[model samples]
Target: MRNGKATIHDIAEKLKVTASTVSRALNDNPRISDATKKRVLKAAKDLNYQPNNIAAALRSGRSKLIGVVVPTANRNFFSSVIRGIEEFANSLNYKVVISQSYDDFEKEKQTIEALLNVQVDGIIASLGKTTKNVDHFKKIISKGIPLVLFDRVTNDLDVSQVVIDDYYGAFQATEHLITEGCRRILHFTSAQNINIYKDRKRGYEDALLKHGIGVDPELILFSDMQLEDGRRIMQETLDRKIEFDAVFSSSDYSVMGAMQVLKENGLNIPQDVKLVGFGNEPFTSFTEPTLTTVDQKSIPMGQITAETFFEILNQKDQGSIIPKKTILKPELIIRNSSINKEN
Candidate 1:
């Protein structure tokens, strides 16, 4: 009875019927008569019959499991994405398992290996900040398993991927500051070799060039984009007397850090210094002066990421090379931080 749990055989024995008939009745096969099906169900209830999902999976050749990997799970953006994936996947009777790499390259590789070992139907992931090699991801492709990437993607793999238009978001932010009468804007970016940061930097530069304000190398600050990094960089910039009237950061955390430092130094936001940040985190709205930032469409990205994974799994030819690439639009959320009341 499978370690005290009632099985199909117990139900069949109770009803004096064959195990096959009980299985068919439980599955609601049309071939079984309604009267017999009703009898089988009654016996199953009385015996507390439980079906073995492992056996069913083996017979059907499907685990009905999906794995999701992210750099950090605590962030609002990644959590929203996970919600979207779970909502859609649950609707299809699939379960999800999530893992975090903490932006560590080795941890990422280990996470992928563990997911693959579990024989999950597919995997959806965002690249880790320190990930520069694609060999671990290639192992999944070699095994003919579907692997879909979202947000932080690498160009080395020909796999289905989803990302926001970072360039456009950055351009919009930079241009908004310019319209607010900010010419010498300081840009806070990450030093890691990630595509999103690179695209944002390019957008920032292009917007400055378009407005006849040349890019200043000294004004571009690079770090991990953490809160402490922002605080330290702003203080250093102030100490060095680098002239800047506005701040455009690629991350909300760093920009928020910059805001605290600015306030502590007796600088007034939108009065003496304008500000804009990427990724409209929840805290942005509750600040003293609301922050202007970009929304990355986290929920939609998660939903589309799940849809893309299923698409790959259901493909007629699993060996196809034409992978899908989806680019979502980013919205600029303007607020009190970047608006110049004087202008």
Candidate 2:
């Protein structure tokens, strides 16, 4: 009846019942008799009746939908987090709408606006690299919508966040390299505009200071942490004759690039130059020499993010929910890449 779709009125007409009775029966109202409810359900099935969720949402003032924004869905870390979010949200009978920012600030703002237009109940997001100004996110708070940040978050926002201890993760990785006798360790990292990368850089520096190794400014190279950037940086380091015994990259892709350059120059891994990477990407384990890296507990982070949103929803006043910061500990995964041959 509504745009050629079967409606409660159609079911009522087929069953020779009033539309109100059919509606109550379809909703399983206790006032409806069991026989009548069964009959209405059967008629609905026969007519293929479908309830309009948008209409129901308008009536109830709740969409039962959650929006998730990530930098990229292609990366294993984000994908795994999404899977965990889906798992928990589905269990609670909630649906999730996902949007990818692609690390672009404009795209991120557009996606958030689109999600808001659809009247989602809540949003969970990781800030994009280019998202320096967070006024757009503040707008979500202004609209009384619950927002939770994960992974790459900003301290300027007073919202719930789920993240790993990136500082400790980097510290452990750097200290591991030092223990393996890597004196002149070159750090391949990304821009410090993002909080996660900044924490990693600080951790790397602190680890060196703790182990009596002075931080070398020339050895700390900043890049986009892409494969090509890694390759280019490594080649330039070689061209400049920079002395380094180990390479600690903030990204697995960057490590792969460095590995390629090292291999081409006939440098043996763990013998000539030890290596370590972050993210614990799948490829790290299967490489010629498995990469030592840090596991960010991405799935757990996702689950916690969803759980926190649910808690926010339960509160009578959204603003009353205290700003929560949940930091999960990072685990160091040791492998062949950074282990000294003598050890």
Candidate 3:
């Protein structure tokens, strides 16, 4: 046995078998008897043998490595989605490499390039807030690598995508606020360049118009939707004396900032001013007066995104498969933040 990393040859030598037989046994080929397979596995374990994935990849032209890009990794929504993706991918003997864009378009592009350089078999990504142009992503398809976009995606790219119905989720959130007797609803969101935010803004506007309320442009505020942005927007609205009975924020972090300002001003929640947020973050349920929000089905989105990638991989030889769009339904979790007492 060599002093270096144990190879299949070492296991074969220990078991008095050929390297080809050891390899077949390791892969659980049907021709290998169960007893032989067990003996080979025990020998491999005893030698601390580790498969050289790089060598195997070179032989098969598949790395079995998946690259994942998210706008940010700190958020619960994205984290949960990643967990789901890893869960499914790991079961299939695939590994995942994760990268965060921090919502920067340049960073997102760089991440894709880096992943490509590593020759990952596939990529799953969520667009950054500033990712209006998808040319960088198109390049991935040009290279014949499978790409799947989740949560944030664009129709410009002919790629498989998994996302929740952002428009309907926003509409439900806004309609719920309106039903709770909030006429002047303020919207706090991120850049409209992102399709998810754009859909949410449209939903908010349409919901108001449906209820015979004229759309107020001033009520809509766009920012990075960070906690500080939320605080600033809320404080600015209060300072300007903007008439608003409720707020529907596109992010939970921003909503928490708004809630802090409301508390500071001694405004009674759900009484003086109701509030709702998108993305059912963990903190939302634990906050005082538990926030009402939309559940984007993040985990399922990731699972389906990974599943879709495998589907494409399986059908790769059947000529190019048509791109598909998978839209999941969002659910509203009503809590003290926006529950109507009279209902």
Candidate 4:
């Protein structure tokens, strides 16, 4: 064994065959005989042979490795997306290198640069909250490397991407509350710069206007949509006496915080204030009155994102990527939180 790891040459020596023969046998090349291939395989197992992917990648210029970047892996949505990416990638004999940006633009830039340094065949990413300038992504395009975005994407970069219909999901949630007789519906959202948050806001506004309930600026609240942000915004609404009958949040985490505040204030869910949250987190089902939420289809999102990346990669040698946008439909799960019978 060389360097405590069995190399192809080590297997060749074990079986008393040429290094080329061992290589061909290991690759299952048609030129090699079945008996010799069987001998090479057994020798490989006995020696615990491992292929040097880096050397192979250098020779072929195809890394068979993909770099995946997300805001954070802590969220169930992002974690599930990673799983989906891995499932699809692994089927094609590819490996994934995951990196987190933690919502920092600088970190995202550095992460992408590091991925480039590793000579990854492609990169699949979701834009971080603070990533307004997309020059880093543009640089990737300029280098003729495949870059596909999913979920949190920007329109500035002409890249292939996939995302759930945030507008439709938000519209459905808002309309559901309206049907529940909620006129003064409160809204929790993030910054308008991000496409998902903006689409959701538009949906909420259109739903209210469609139902003859004008959008009240006072009822609209903006924040990072973190747990603390939800609690702070909700408390601010009550302190200012915004007068809201229902709450619709763009994030399940934030709405959970709002629920805690409501319970503390002695407000009965679905009785006094109907609530609906986006992102069908697992905890939503276990809540006191089970929070109504939207399913972003994380599994499908990840699968499609992987497919989109490969599509771009397969077409790279042909020319630049012809940017494609795939929008998936989201599902709204109705639960005890949004069904107010007495309202």
**TM-score, per-candidate, Cα-based:** 0.88, 0.92, 0.89, 0.91
Higher-ranked by TM-score: 2 or 4: 2
Provide the lDDT at 304 for model 4: 92
Tens-digit per-residue lDDT, 1-343, candidate 1:
6688998888888888899999999989999999999999888888887777567767776779898999998889999999999998999989999999999999999999998877788889998889998899999989898999999998999898999999999999999999888999999998447889999999999999999999999999998888899899999999999999999999999999999999999999989999999989999999989999999999999999998888888887898747989999999999999997754
Give one digit per residue, the lDDT tens place, for model 4 in 92-127.
999999999999999999999999888899899999
Error of 4 at 124 (Å): 1.1
Candidate 3 shows a clash count of 0
lDDT of 3: 0.91
lDDT of each: 0.91, 0.91, 0.91, 0.91
Q: List the residue pairs that clash in candidate 2.
A: none
Give the runs in model 4 whose Cα sits over 4 Å from its true position: 1-6, 10-16, 33-49
Best by TM-score: 2
Candidate 3 lDDT, 185-251, residue by residue in tens:
9999887778899999999999999999999999999889999999999999899999999999999
Ten residues in sequence with the least summed lDDT for candidate 4 = 313-322
Candidate 2 lDDT over 1-343, as tens digits, reads 7677998888888889899999898878999999999999998888878777677777778888899999999899999999889889999989999999999999999999999888888899999988999998999999989999999999879999999999999999999999999899999988688889999999999999999999999999999888999999999999999999999888888989999999999999989999999998999999989888899898998899999989998788876779989999999999999997776
